[model samples]
Target: MSWRQARTAHVTMTFDPEGLTPTQREGDACVACHKKWPRPRIRIGRLPDDTTLFACPECADALLPQQDDTHSLPWRVAFS
Candidate 1:
């Protein structure tokens, strides 16, 4: 029903001609909130695939798992 504030920034709804909008369809655009970050962050799932699921900025970042981190554990163990 309201937009979430992110990093002191406000997010408002601006309808797109592409028709890609938030999955929420009950109130004033956003279902719960919006976000602003010091770094680049976006909700990947909110691209209007028509799915109610979403990966928040944090979740999206985690999902993108650091390329180096994935191999760090294996290098430490030196498995044959």
Candidate 2:
């Protein structure tokens, strides 16, 4: 399946290997498409109220903005 523009910029994926388990399964459905996902890479999005929602890779990619300028923002400023 092809990925589309993002729905929002609050989406993210976890990379913590310690948090994963062989028997662990993702029971949450994609917030955008409402489809069940079994894959280990779960997508999470933050709501307006700060609540986290899970989505599939397709949905996450589809929901992300195509050209967001905020990505250029600096995390820290260099002292002069």
On lDDT, the leading prediction is 2
- Model 1, runs deviating above 4 Å: 1-54, 69-80
Query: What C-alpha lDDT does candidate 1 achieve relative to the native structure?
Result: 0.33
Provide the clashing-pair count of each candidate structure.
2, 5
Name the weakest run of 10 consecutive residues (lDDT summed) in model 2. 17-26
The 0-to-1 C-alpha lDDT of every candidate, in the order given, reads 0.33, 0.46
Candidate 2 on 1-80: residue-level lDDT in tens? 22223433443533332343322323355665656546314445444444455657776566554555454444365232
Q: What TM-score goes with each of the models?
A: 0.20, 0.39
lDDT of 1 by residue, 1-80 (tens): 22222311122223332543333331223322433233323323332334332234564445433333443446457665
- Top candidate, metric TM-score: 2
